[model samples]
Target: MEAIANGLILLMLSIGHAELWTSVINRTHALKIHEVYLKRLRHVLELLMVLFPLVLLFAVGLSDPGVLVGGEWSQLPLWWQPILLLCTLGFLGLIYSGVRHQFYRPPRQQTAQESELIHLRERLKQDLIGEGPYHYLAGLPFNEIFSVEFTRKTFQLSRLPEKWEGLTILHLSDLHFSGTLKREYFIELCRIAQEMKPDLIIFAGDLIDRMECLDWLQETLGPMQAPLGRFFILGNHDWNQESLQIRQTLSETGWIDLTAEPVRLQHEGQTLFMAGTEAPWMGKLQDVKLSEDNAADDFLLLVSHTPDNFHWAEREGYDLVLSGHTHGGQVRVPPFGPIFAPSLHGTRYTSGTFFRGSTLLHVSRGVSGIHPLRWFCRPEISLLTLHSADKK
Candidate 1:
């Protein structure tokens, strides 16, 4: 029993070490640096996260006079103390994040909401794309890559202006049309989104991973109909491609380039300011005009590719922010939630409706990603219905 307990402890510490460095790698990916540099840093950290634990295990658990043999704690070398301390600290930090995730609640600023989840796999079993990368993993018994969820959620916010009440926005992001999943998958998801009949449509970045998939747009996002219009911003993946061509092709397909400039809409005598930000990757953030009288009355909506911009959006007095780069960590571990999110905030904004001060952020669990794998996390599209809480 003693030997078993010591072995378990070593395993726990190894996991902690990996998690610690994974947090660092996620934040590093959020920097305004080049992708090549970020990839190099990630590889180094990941190697350390794995190999360091194995070295320590060989030294302390597998050798003579080691803990696994029920050796006295004092038998360890003096130099090992600080390393053990760091391992313990990292384990504790991992526990704290888990606790927070287990107890996480929707922000108090949100008054009420309803969510309906539609499992596409069940509805269109034979119609799914049926082929993609990671066939080894996607073929796993419960892999959720093809189980797209059409999540229709309503948000009742006190800040919603009367004119915008009952307004619906279909939020889509991170399509990553890398051909890992065939074009049919994207076409079907987009068709369902159009069926939702939203007043406005927003694609919050990461449209495609392969330029060859560019032709997939017309049958997918091109025909999407919304009275308010379709707007988009490019994500880091798009930056790695022929971004200028991507932008031009998207514009020609009729989606307005929100990152190019801020858009102001006058509706039912109400003002709405909309803009997009692709910071830390693509374009710069567009500033809302201050010249308009009663600028405060305009309901401000900022579309950011990364939810890490939540703080900046809050400070800028945005009423709502939409984003979708993290893909809800691509996979979620129960109790611990998401373990891998590419954001400065770690997994805090993995996917959800979070309210900070006056700004409400809705992060999408995007449809597909580069890895083409998912466990507990399913591909998601959200139809967000905004309602006024003043009626409450």
Candidate 2:
């Protein structure tokens, strides 16, 4: 009985220790460290999990368990035993609570059909920005382990016009084009976008990272064609002195700049109102209010760099809002979700499709970012299909 009790205690302690370590690992920010070092640490931790039980068994067997040769409990003051028992009980309670929470948590309602464009995460092991000796040695080995998934989200809107029910908008954002990412990458992305054959292409923001990459814009993004048109808005990154040149380059490439004012398009016997606001970081957004004349029977769509305008969009009675800035927190951990999101409201509107009353907001993880590393948080191209809820 004493041996059995000791074994049970050891088992509980082992489980608790492993659980505590897992929680710490999931919550800890490891992006600051080099990839090579983090990989080595992870390997060591995995090895320890296997060795821990054996070590515990050996220690427990060799140590005194307050038992006598007569098969009776020792009478000597074992004050520490009660304390150990209490700690074990507390750990057990914590484990139970975690399990219950996981099992009882409500599932998030999904409105998107997610599909992988490239299985690069499984195929490639080199980083996208393969430069410098440090990156080659530390990051390259783990490169391309990150995915860039394309999601098709269909939102059933009661106010959606019947003619626009099948209208597909291919949303792209945060294409942080610099020397780090080659033009070939963008060309490949354009090929994929072309194949998807969206009726409209909307670029939310962050088209270029630096002024030098400005020339590559037309060659890279000019190939992406849509039947209706391709519209673009400026991100905070685009609000520099070179912005005028960037806008000119985009215009020459046959892209419509929707930054100055809202544009109304007549498509398939229905009116579609599309508007874009300047990034809040780049000073105040232009006062493009939706009037009663513009509101009647038309589908209102707004684009912004950040999801900060979700409330504003909701208040303005916009049917849909597309955005990308947070990069889906860049790295997401299972159970804990996104570790860090660059938004005013934090991780509240990080990524994916969200319903704010009748308005649907879709935030993309984006094609690329300034930082090259992405874990469970994959970069994305969002394809949104509008469905009229009333027709269904």
Candidate 3:
């Protein structure tokens, strides 16, 4: 009984210590770390972490530690008693922190006015193209199936203008349309999105993966209908293809390219100023300067491919920002959230809605990825309804 108790306490301590160190690495180095090397290191660390407690138990048992051998408290070495007590307290503290973070933390409130059923056809087949042998060997091919979840989230802000109340915007991003994802999949997505009857449509870049899918854009994306208008910005992946051609194609399809310029529109008696910036990775982010004089009483909105611009948007007094790029970290782990997110802040701005001062940032998980495998992270198309908190 004594040995068993000691072993359990030691195990908890080991787990707590491992988690603390892992968090340090994830928060500090994950963004800068190389993918393959980081993955390999994480795997090796996990294996060693799990085996540590067992190895420690064996060593203590062989040495016949007084505490493990059921010796009286007073008979145990004075130093050993304090060490055990400290370890036990540290483990309990870790447990308390975990419980508090899980149940007591105040998460941002997200209210949904309505959500439509994600209609997936029964005959929709899973098709994997150009997938390497590693995918099949690792059972990742099963995760490559194209599916979408349509979410309608309402954001009520006290600062929101009453004239723009109940404004619905459809947000789409990261349509990594490589050969793996078929044209029909996007067509189905657009069909469902059109049914939402959004007042405006915003595409936050990474619309195409390769040049081969360029024709699919006009055939599938052209049919999307919106009452107000459609706007788009380029992402890192968009530059992989001919950026000029993509911009021209979008213009020809009646989609306004908001890159590097702010456009003003009158909607429902409200003045809306929508602007976009080139992705920071593309070296043209500086060109997207917004003029203070142009903002005149207009509801300012920005479209950025990466959430890294959230700070800039907030500093410039923008009310809302739509962005994508992290793809919700591609794979999310419960409680711990995303294991990796490609940003300077790591997983801080990976996905979902966030508030920076008065600026609200919505980061989409995206329509698709370079590789189709996604676990616990579903592809998303969001319908955002903006409401004035002051109205009610």
On TM-score, the stronger of 1 and 2 is 1
Score residue 228 of candidate 2 by CA lDDT. 94
Tens-place lDDT per residue, model 1, 224-291, is: 98998999998998998888999999999999998888888777788778888888787555453333
RMSD of every candidate to native, in Å, equals: 2.3, 8.8, 5.7
Best by lDDT: 1
Candidate 3 per-residue C-alpha lDDT over 80-180 given as tens digits, one digit per residue, 9 for 90 to 100: 66555654564554555445334532125346535444534343554434442233422354452455678889887656678777889999999877766
The parts of candidate 1 lying over 4 Å away from their true place are: 33-37, 111-136, 286-294
lDDT-better candidate, 2 vs 3: 3
lDDT of 2 by residue, 192-304 (tens): 77788999999988777667788788777888899999999877556632667887888889999887778999998888898887656443554666866885789899887
Candidate 1 is scored at a TM of 0.92
Question: What TM-score would you give candidate 2 relative to the actual structure?
Answer: 0.69
- Candidate 2 wrongly placed segments (more than 4 Å): 1-112, 120-146
Could you say which candidate leads in TM-score?
Answer: 1
State every prediction's TM-score relative to the real structure.
Answer: 0.92, 0.69, 0.72
